[model samples]
Target chain A: MAPTLCELCKTTRALIVRPKNHQKLCKSCFISIFETEIHNTITSNSLFFPGERVAIGASGGKDSTVLASVLKTLNERHHYGLNLILLSIDEGIKGYRDDSLKTVKRNAKQYDMPLEIVGYDELYGWTMDQVVEQIGKKGNCTYCGVFRRQALDRGAARLDIKHVVTGHNADDTAETVMMNLLRGDLPRLARATSIVTASAASDIKRSKPLKYAYEKEIVYYALHKGLDYFTTECIYSPEAFRGSARTLIKNLEKVRPSAILDVVKSGEDMARLVPDEVSAAGQGGKDVLVVEGEAYRAGGCGSANGRSSGGEMADTERQLLESEKAQGNETEISHLGQKHDRNCKIPNRTLRKLPKQQMGKCVRCGYLSSQDICKACMLLEGLNKNRPKTQIQVSVDEEDNSSRLTRRMESLKIIPAEQM
Target chain B: MSTQSNEAGMVLLEVEFTGGLELLFSNQRKHKISLPGSDEKGQPATAAFLVRYLCENLMKDTRKEMFVMDGTVRPGILVLINDADWELEGGDLYELKENDNFFFISTLHGG
Candidate 1:
């Protein structure tokens, strides 16, 4: 076979077949074009201000590794004047997290950026290993998801850095869109599709710089550049809900490469239709900015939690907590059942009149929370109260269930026969 | 690295798998594989033929679906032929040549 000329250079043999668009380019042109697109995403979104300290949430995974390398190159070439730091969360899995953090350490040196690691032990007084021990790994992801969300904020706060960026690519975002759409989690769908989820109530701002980038491209960039990265599934069982959605997206991409980006565009378009009243009050008036070429952040905080599944579960838990806060306003039981009941008339009205986000410091940790105590504090209270490792189980008969999310949870349930 | 590619001969190639796909390829990232120059139908061997060779002869893992589906590399796995995107080189139909470098990278793993 004859070599194909690069689309841009037209001189060198093309090495890359871009997934978003089927453009083929040589290595040098591909690298530049990838970086330039990311630069456009950053600039048009105004993700960073000059001299601002932004932490690259690093897991030593390919996405973060590529993100660090590209951001460093862009910062130097474009004179962005950004102080980029590598922030990692050590979930304290005996063999898993301990090894990935080493890659992050090497990345810190390789990228010449300062590194900060916040562990589950320091934040929650419980590593994932211990959490899995207590919770029996059935629903430990809920704990990790809740804890990691706050941990990233707390880590950024500790560094006195307000803005944190993650390596969530287009595929991840597209998967989240599909997951949220399937789950009917409109508020979270709105949250997930935002390039920047910024709340004045909290100092830490979260953004995804690689939101427009494709996962394949990120891995390709890492491999082509020989950027050091680690790839391993979490020691814990995977979340079935997001896994199915991810599988669907991968299959769709296989058939149509543009399907991923199309899903992202559809998510953004759907987000715009979310009632302003719903968006305005959900995250303490957190403006969900859909910046131009501003890619939506996929499971950004799922670095330590693992995979798109972690992000979906965490978002569900978050929605649960927020709804709990809403129901705390004198409602006896959660409207979860009623909300899912299509015939329930009052639930629609009730959903529209969401309770104003009650921003307050967690009584235990001083972190931002809508409840009297944050979700983490609430989970910790439960764990500390049940020290003897009581089996906590939520039994939902899968056959009669109408909610796809519930059925997914049913499948993801770790069977007792498959114990560690 | 045998460079001979006579019609009735065999092609020696370097097949590398990474990003955890090596777990299926005998937990080895790089394998030197010798494959017949032509298939049983007497047609020139191609990448699709190599995928079958790896599955039937080299794959130590039981999860064949993880690597191949519908007669091609699985959706998430990337194929690079001689440092070029296999998509540019005709994907699964690209004829295998002696001493070619084939890298199969799985993007399914956590980033």
Candidate 2:
């Protein structure tokens, strides 16, 4: 085939080899278009400093891997003089984390970046499996979530970096915007759409350079560049929560190509009209502000100790721990009656108490806690209330129950089993 | 009705919004509103009544009247008084006489 003209620079050289759509450009020019856009994003947002240290939260995922590659490229081309480090949080989930971490390490080596991997077990004292085994199916995400977030923040802090960047993309932001709207979360919808980090937010200003980038484009970019990325989803995801949001976003996007842009535009518009209550550089009264439903935390030191976590732990932890202490908290509660001892409660408390409204309900199974019996137990209470009709199981093998439910759910097509 | 000793005195309305709705309302103009009004909290239809009553009250009273909603009031906020800024008075809460101004601002946050 004759060499096609470059889309951006009109170069007649096939600098780009085998672009998916026969798109042609000299390697340098084709690259400039993409690189320049990233540079613009960083400069416009002031996401990086000339010599300031910045940490990238790499997950070995398409978005993150691309972010690392582009940031490195931009740092060199734009001379942002950024000291960039790759920070990967290993949640210690079996296939999921181990595989992803391998990619992160490889990418770090390829990019010649300094890399740091903080394990869920090391930071939070428990992996997803152990947490699941101990805490059981009622609230599996509780562990990885609280632990993963703080793990990233703590990792950034350990590096003594001034900024932390994540791989959140346009799709993710749009999904979140829709999620907030459906839930009537005006503040979050107003605040979450920016392509840059709120440099004003203190405690290691977190950002998302990919907020405007499309997920499809990111995946395509990674594939085209032959970058390593993990294809597995989090193992314990039941597809009962954010899964719905993800699906909704996908559907909306299919219906309207500009759905993501519209959502982001709305969020931006709302932000302009809201109070000056933004937490700038983590200073000001808004700096101390906290919101509900958003439990992602800036990791701090000694996160694994259990002693550092506050309210979330007290409620979920104390209840489970106190119950387990009496009934071998080591023992996992099952869908049916059986038990396996597991050790974890500190970080789970952070999960439970994330939203005061949610915490008032039992974390065990998302129910209002009345007296000592939370919703998880309350479900059993209802079962027992059936007298001879309901045979209840309070303590059992945690994994077994979840798997059982997972299998049943698969059979019923409630969620595709492969997703789990 | 022009008694200098208006025993009714000034009525103050304090409305605290739910979340980050405070930054948007920073542009309100501190002006007179002379709407004869109602003394209540979360009363529906307060926007129109407030605009009319506050306009009439402040223009007539000549006392600096204000509407105190959280800084995150919604767009299209009907502040038919002056500019709806309480900065001239005591920030969000304005001082006044009877028939002073009352403004309705919207703030939205949920779980």
Instruction: Tell me, by TM-score, which candidate is best.
Output: 1
All candidates: DockQ: 0.69, 0.01
Cα lDDT for residue A155, candidate 1: 87
Interface root-mean-square deviation, each candidate: 1.0, 21.1
Q: Which ten residues in a row have the lowest lDDT in candidate 2 chain A?
A: A350-359
A-chain TM-score in candidate 1? 0.77
lDDT measured at residue A22 in model 2 versus the true structure, 0 to 100: 31
> What would the per-residue lDDT of candidate 2 be over residues A305-358, giving only the tens digit for each residue?
132222232132123223222322211111111112122112211111111111
Off by over 4 Å in 2: A1-31, A196-202, A278-420, B1-111
For candidate 2, what TM-score does chain B get against the true chain B?
A: 0.25
Q: Which candidate is the best by DockQ?
A: 1
Model 1 bad stretches (over 4 Å):
A199-201, A284-352, A387-420, B1-8
Query: Which 10-residue span in candidate 1 chain A carries the lowest summed lDDT?
Result: A293-302
